[model samples]
Target chain A: MKQIFRTIAMIFVLCLAASPSFSQTGKTETYPPIDSDALEQFGGPEGVRNWVESLFYYIMLDNRINHVFREFGNIERQIYLNTQLLQLVLGGNEVEYQGASMAAAHADLGITLTQFNAVVEAAYNACERIQLTYEACNLMIAGLAPYKHAIVTR
Target chain B: MEEAKRAKFPVSKGAALVVAMLASGLSQAGWYDSGKVLATGGVSMIDGAGGGGITPWATITGYGTKEGINGDLHYTYAPLANYTLHSLGAAVGFWDRFELSYTSSALTTGSTFDTVGLVADTLGGVTGSLAGTPINTGIEPFNTTIEMESIGAKVRVFGEAIYDSDNLIPQIAIGGFYKNNKNEDLLKTLKADKAKDWEAYISATKIFFPINTLINITARYTAANQTGLVGFGGPDGSDKEIRPEISLAYLLRKDTVIGIEWAQHGDNLEGESVEIAGLDLTGLQPTLEALGLGNVSGTLTQHESDWYDVFVAFFPNKNLSITMAYAMLGNITITPDQHGFYMSLQASF
Candidate 1:
């Protein structure tokens, strides 16, 4: 009987250990700042494309490609993609192109440019809160260099 | 060992009971309202319209300016010389955004001996055999009865079509139903081969409104595949069938609609011998068995019946509506004409 009790207790312990917990954890993680030096390196229209490519890679690593593409059930991802796209363009050279306005460009692409701008500002503010590094800022800048004109012109 | 093997997966009697409850529940609920009398209509909801109401139509209608959720209730009854059928269904929706539904049906079919004396005489044939009489005994009366129930959930992927902003866009919906047919015990009692099967269906709807208030139309097609009915046949040799329907609704008021619909099943059309590679039968028996009915066989022929419904709906608010409808079956092969009436009240946030 004692052995049977021990066996039942062990089985109960194993079952409890295998169960998944549904409680929420209170700890929150902060994101790093934008890489401004990389932004400067990739400044201007020539830098915009590279910046978009880097942002694309970051988003992919983050498992947010569908959000960027505006596919099914990715509204939050779409906002993030639009914001990053705008930050790369505005943060680059101040040359303006003769296409649609940034807002219109975003609209044409099935997103709201105002929303994108808001997201960019929020991201920048968040970076300050975390005291982001200059290297990180520069990396983001460099990535934006390739499509600077496309961003500003739109 | 054989009994143990049978017990291991012996068709779940509990699951069968649950299915029976669901089937009866849905049929009695009667909430889905299809809009057309015989054809399909464009898929869209004008403030009280429901998805079940959308029938197939050739032209696009009800593009834009149509919004609202519609709820429906439906029931069907068939009384045949050999069997009886009772079905109930109910459905609710929100701005055509989401839908939840349930249906249940009970069928009592096969031969019933009205007199005990006749049954005793039939039994006497067996006793006579013991007496060494060479008289041939006639076959005893055999009958089959079946009951099935199912539940489903659906969502609208898109609200409006891209190219035609005025029309209700195509909606993609997916749902599954659990059916329980009660004839398995009868099949076992008769020592006949049978199995209980599950069935599923998927469909799309497009609604069109031409000339605004005068005519609203919709077209819809559904495909169903299922298996497992004791004594009749198994899923291995079951066939799939498509149902197409059309509906037309006339707007009596901004918040009111009156419509008619016609629907047909492709599996058991008139005059078609209901048989598969490994099974043989005539009409409703095989179809019901394919649909998860165990031992229920009826006088109804396979696919020999079509359905018609007339319905009215009233919407008092954006999220609430009430509907009333009546349906009848025509060209029935084995039953007295079937008739049904239903009323449903629904709300969604």
Candidate 2:
């Protein structure tokens, strides 16, 4: 038994000794870069900012309604509503109509800088045809919707 | 006087067998002190063979480490046809580096025909031969039951020897444990005393995260002193053994791990013949002295084995975990073939 244990120990030591070389040499794959320049031309900073403002207002409105009426409290429902609103406003050049109200509401809710950047990214994709439609907007809204609860609770 | 000498040898032989078996079994089982307290930055749970280091990785699972303290309460239960054993233990850490623990267990071996059979004839002979009634005619129904209890305390000390940026750290630890057992009627019948055993051990674990999702390997070794249950025989016969262990763990998720380990123990040592101090007229002594020729007092000599274990652990949150393990005993000499499976849940506050 002692001999067996010693052999097992030696095997483990050798494996431990060999691991570092494998780890050090293994190549780390990187992700494809996001094109910020192409993104800027689609909406410029102002257009992106306006789209973000609108999305925030929709999120806050949904949170208020869900807080008051337990049946509508689902975050997914809020995301659906935000998607529909973004579709109607961004269908053409209707950005000016909803931009100010959305921006004011988000600012009032104390949205953090990180969250604001996320909102801008989402809006830029929505307007530049990257997202291109209400269904796409809804997907983005659903993805960002969970963050609303986190922000509010924090 | 002849009977007294005869009795001495068998008792001594049995004691020798027990010592040899225990030393061999434990060494194979990789007996050791899990150096490092509950708060120390090492493995948090003890494995099936009563050893430590269940695959070390860079990510810390429990609250115990070199800088803080952690404590836990655990229970184990195993039931067989004639006996049932239960153990409850508690461990605590000091300054995240040193650990102290205590465990108490109760073993209840139900009524036995062998013990009853021995008493019936011995008692019948004592009474009938004096009264001139045949001993067999005087025999009557006899009942025998046995219960055993054991308690142990352990302490472990551990620290890091090398630390690197890749999260690989080499650490070593030393620990000691003392165990005491009480058996109600068995000791009295065998003319033996309670059992006491002490063990000290040292081990090292070096964690290498050569791969992001795997903990390459961990190894350990331990040595301990055997306990003699047969009383007044040979200076309290003790044996020493060496055991080495190795294990590998792969992370299924950040909070879950799976691993397997193998360990083996060295042979038992032959020691000097024990003195049967006060008992008189027993035929057991000479038989024992004859077998003492090859014994060594403090080192390993004969009878050893090896064991294998597979285990899994789940960490649902930062302060709680559950583990399951199975072990197979191999090359046993005096004891029956044994297999054990265990499940344990631990939480710290």
Candidate 3:
């Protein structure tokens, strides 16, 4: 049994050592460039600001993730940044996100998967409450999907 | 007694480390010493630290990591008709980079020892002889408690399982466990590996944030057959096999999750002939047949069953959580169609 196990381990180690293709795991994913039409569907800059407020409202009440924002009062800047970021990502040239990158913004916050997922969930729920068309909501979520890696630092 | 004390030294050290981390962590507060997001650190697995029932994943076990430290303690119970398993576990995660964990399990095997003729083995008789009657080792009616301990460590190598919404790069982690069981003498007669064994694994996890879906895959390689449940090694030789496990979870709420976990295992105890744990049943076949029991062909040694558990985990707060799962044990080797329920309570910081 020991000999057989050794042989198997040897094969495994060799496979890992010899397989260069296995190193492709750390690369980032890319999505198609956002178009202006989808941004319009997400409801322009003012609509996005309202949507941000709605999402944060849900986030404040969410038990799973509310603790993270307990001390982060005064989210006016956050709202502004999010609105501009959403507009820019949705193919609108009306606003530009001038804040730090997502990774930098959340690096010290030590965001967790559950918190991240809650944020996404709240965003979706807010979209629902806003009565955006189902397709448009789906599009909005897809548009925000790519920022998870950057926003989640922990 | 001295050896036992010596054996506990490392665990004590680990505990001390946890205490020290906690002490220092308490000095600075208000930023949420728990560090990472709430409920992001999953509850513990049966034999290791991770999500799912039997499989471990790349994610660490707490909300800390990126900033602080995470610690948790858990207890689990699983009961079947012939067996009951009770386990206790503890884990500590630092910076989300590394984790150290320990788990101990006590399993009561009912009416199994007597049927296997432990008395005969103790009295220097043949492998299965008690008062001149060949003991039916395959089917038993005696109960005995078996104890096993496992210590594990894991580290996340690169990438992340969650939060990397745009990254195809799945979170990967490397981990291993050292397990020791007290049933050494009987296992020795069966040509098993040893009283202790090691298993190594690599896991990858990915979370697609938009869909709120998390998928995890893990591959493990080990020589301990049946996860060392039916004993390890066999007469035919024990070979390590790479087993794969997959887990999928849906976020019903931010704090509530329901998931399905499936883990594949290998059988390494087929051995040669009808030797049931070194007690060859060939000699008793005719005798049993004459008694109207038919030739009890003892070919039940190689039964390895995959474990499937559908679990629901709810975390009302970051520090407290509970998991309830229904596990399908498939084939229990000595028994047939053994399934059971599992519930675990976990507290984390």
Candidate 4:
């Protein structure tokens, strides 16, 4: 019994180890066409605006990244640009984000991964405040997850 | 900007409390950052390794990021049908790259000794009547505990488990544990070759974000019998071999997850023949079998089974987590199908 188990286990381990051994390198500047379903879940562009506003409130309250936001200044402009970007990402083709690219925007911010995750947490709490479905929140998180590489310069 | 400072956020008290407790108070020290996302740092495994209930993964133990440190303490209790297992441990993660851990584990074998005593009495009666001489198997029925201490270390080799979400490559790590059993005399009676040994393993863990699923695979090489509680190696089949463990977890929510794991064990004492005070019992196997008592060698043979568990973990906040599981630990020495409920509580800082 031991020999048989060893043989089967060895085969299984070898297969898992051999597959997908290479890392995903490089980056893409293009975003996928807006997810209309997700936009609908967020109740279109107006709902997205409210969600971003709620997110700003949490961000200011969060001690981890609030100081960075305070240092950046221009709270109103930050909210406008973020709302537009979120709308476009959630499939609102009616508006275009006239802001800097994610990497360029945060390049000089010295933002650490910890601070980046803090922003994500703030966004999650905002979703809960707005009563977004669990699936909707996950979709939003998955949509925003890839931006971590560009934003976390530190 | 000044207006934003007085924005009246109206956030939940729970959120405020978690943020105040986890993010504040330690920034000046530049340590205990608790920077990792919630649930990213897994709970401590049975052997104090950072992973699930029984299997270790590639992820580090605490919420520390690459620039900071974090640590936690855990206690686990598992009561099987014939025995109970208890473990308490502490682990510290250094910059989320390296980990050091220590665990003390105990197994209560009081009930198991009753069955062992029965076997010894039956074997002694048969041998004494057949050979016209009394033989002592040296099996005592007294209740005693098997205790062990382990020190473990792990280093993440490459890849990222939580970040780099757009990848198929998993985070890989290498680790080892040095375990020493406290019961030296009991192990010698059980014919264990050694009381202490080291085990090594390589683990690969990946999180598939789209599915909210995590898969971790580990291959461990060791000769420790029953995870070194009963001792290392043995007089029977003592060979250090690679055993595979796998875990699959699905994130039910951001702070909740359910998972299952399977870990194989080395059967180091299978087919061992009994010896009573330097007297070989192989010659009595046929007679014992004819008497409907089975082979005499079988009395001493130990067959171990793989371990499996289905567990659910809830992260109430970053600082605390509670995990409950149904653990199926197949056989411990002569006991069969030793399975029961297991639970663990961990507090991180």
A-chain TM-score, model 1: 0.28
- When summed lDDT is taken over every stretch of 10 residues in candidate 4 chain B, the lowest stretch is B2-11
- Preferred candidate (DockQ higher): 1 or 4: 4
Instruction: Tell me the tens digit of each residue's lDDT in model 1 across B203-301.
Output: 344332221122323322222211122222323343434455555565454456677866653332334322322223333354445545434333323
The 10 consecutive residues of candidate 2 chain A with the worst lDDT sum are A24-33
Judged by DockQ cut-offs, is candidate 3 incorrect, acceptable, medium or high?
incorrect
Task: List ranges where model 2 is wrong by over 4 Å.
Answer: A1-154, B1-62, B80-83, B110-169, B184-194, B211-236, B263-305, B330-335
lDDT of 3 at B162: 57
Q: Give the per-residue lDDT of model 3 (tens digit) for A1-154.
A: 5885576467556644653331112222222223336666777767777888888889889987787776655677777777877776566664556877777777788877547767876886788778765456545665666566566665
lDDT of 2 by residue, B53-158 (tens): 2322222222443334444555555443333445555555433355454455554434423332343345345544666654231112433323222222233333
lDDT of 2 at A26: 16
| DockQ-sorted candidate list, best first | 4, 3, 2, 1
- Writing each residue's lDDT as its tens digit, candidate 2 over A25-52 gives 1121111111223223324434444555
Task: Tell me the deviation in Å of residue B75 in model 2.
Answer: 1.1
What lDDT is reached at residue B94 by model 2? 39
Q: Model 1: runs farther than 4 Å from truth?
A: A1-154, B1-50, B53-98, B107-146, B159-169, B174-176, B185-210, B213-236, B267-303, B316-322, B331-333, B339-349
- Measured by lDDT, the strongest candidate is 4
TM-score of chain A of each: 0.28, 0.27, 0.74, 0.76
